[model samples]
Target: MDRRIDGLRVLACLMVVLLHVSSSHIHEFGPKWWSANVWDGLSRACVPLFFMLSGSTLLGRSESLTDFFRKRALRILPPLLLWSCFYLWWLWHNNAPTGNWLLAILRGPTMFHLWYFYAIAGLYLFMPVMRRFYQYSTQQEKIFFLVTWFLVASVYPTVQSLYTDVQCGRAGLLGDVYQLQYFGGYLGYLVLGAYLAERRIAWQKGAALFAVSSVGTILLTYWLSKRLGMPCEFFHLYLTPLVVLAAAGAFIAFLGQPAAPSSAGLQWLSGCTLGVYGLHPFVIDRLLISRGWMNSTGWVWIDPLIGTAAVFLVSLAVIGAIRLIKPLRWMV
Candidate 1:
């Protein structure tokens, strides 16, 4: 039986929704417009949850490497290629690119942002060995990974900011590690997730830890963004720290309780989550966040809540519709 981790999945996907919805510049005529720093901090944990969950679920050694690669390839590449094509069509319709059609299709799509597909695909390809390492890796090795993650994705962001407006300079192991500090950022969180899987951490403690870390990170993020005038770009202290905090919190919250398929609501929510992921961008980008939605009275979060609701509704509809399809039925 699939140990359904849907609650966490739904939560993570919703966090992604929150991030997308909150970051938009849309505003409307409503009183529910205040943004929550808490939510901002909470949402940052979504991607890390995704990566960690994937590691926990898919890292099992029940399949051949060939089987593993094929399954992951089907799951990730199909959507990635399909979305890339969709984005290519979008760009062509907008006359945004007139260059080589194939090349442009490969390189020029908002679908490109779906790079998480690539990242996951890459991670999954190594599931066999990563899982093996989890079984054998020492605590010191784990520390090395987390330390590297901190130096690059977390610390480097602050260091780079001091130079201001400087473009990419020397690219090294450290720089690459610093660039994107999620999913262990260099195997830290991944290992943590695996370790928890191996040890069976308790849920309540994880939840409490999550709560604490999330609060701390958000406070730091706000101070940096509001007072220091620093943008919350990836690798920045505030954002990276927030992401790290969220990632840690997510692991604790998620792994504390083993996700069994016994729960009805969890299965239901998990079924709808993929729908949430695929369909949300359309409404958020097209309707709620279209333009001037951010011009609300003063409250910043009002639009995000409304937008999140709208996206969730669309996601539900999409999920329902997908459930009805014969060929595309697997998406939901």
Candidate 2:
């Protein structure tokens, strides 16, 4: 992996932690709600960045389908299943009324964050086909596809949210006729990652895009939420226009960085990020509810930052210990 990509993984993991930590206060309408919202909005790029990173790394590979599945099965499947079961058990232990163990695992993620595992698995299934498409497609065709995806996946939803009563029945029907949904979703991010990875983006350009889109996201989210008289998430959606730009900008910025050999510690932390993600929610639950750190300092603004750092470090420690055990290390 590119050392810069590793840096991105580490950064994305931190942003994910910050997002979850800040999210708890989004609905509180407390004194710090706006601050929390800002953090949340900024951190929304985390997931998209992860998807892009996956694309950059995966789509260019020349492995056979059998080889791809063999690798994924060994790496991703076990962790997905084991973590799903673990979370289900955690929920049951918390008296959350997990209906059926087998069914729950089959039904999807047992926890909110576990959804990413399922989604990645779905993407893995289509990657072989996507790779062929990417391999054969011309640059202009890819650009056209990406633009169409942006219009469908990002711009359309934003328009709908802004103009709830404006009916586009015929246009929507036309979209359905053409199956535009096929062009939308996280698949675009995958292709986008592969596409952008081949280019050399200037650091200044990437930084400018990141700064502008991030601020736009913050303002747009605040405006939408206030207009709707609730905590609106339209602008925060991973596929939202600003978020797409932000994720792309961030990825480009990472790619634009001057190359350096990754330190042993940075590589170790990057390897630990997946485990940190899987375990952080549980750690957060323990800290906020079990340890009463939800309002630790009585300053809402300060609490989320403190809590995010604590959860991330605690999760990393737990995962580090897990990595020590021979049989369990693969799951991380």
Q: What does the lDDT come to for candidate 1?
A: 0.61
lDDT of 1 by residue, 1-332 (tens): 23336667777888888877775421221233225455566677787777777776765557777888877776776566666665566667878864675675455345534766666766775678777766566877766765666666555554565456533222233456544434234345565555556566676677777777777666665555555554342231223554666576667666566556647656766766655676667666666656645334455546566667777777777677776685776533
lDDT of 1 at 54: 79
Clashing pairs in 2: none
Give the count of colliding residue pairs in each prediction. 16, 0
lDDT of 2 at 2: 62
Q: TM-score for every candidate vs. truth?
A: 0.78, 0.94
lDDT of each: 0.61, 0.85
Over 4 Å off in model 2, which ranges? 165-174
Per residue, candidate 2 scores C-alpha lDDT tens digits across 45-71 of 999988999899998889988999999
Q: Give per-residue lDDT, candidate 2, residue 223.
A: 88
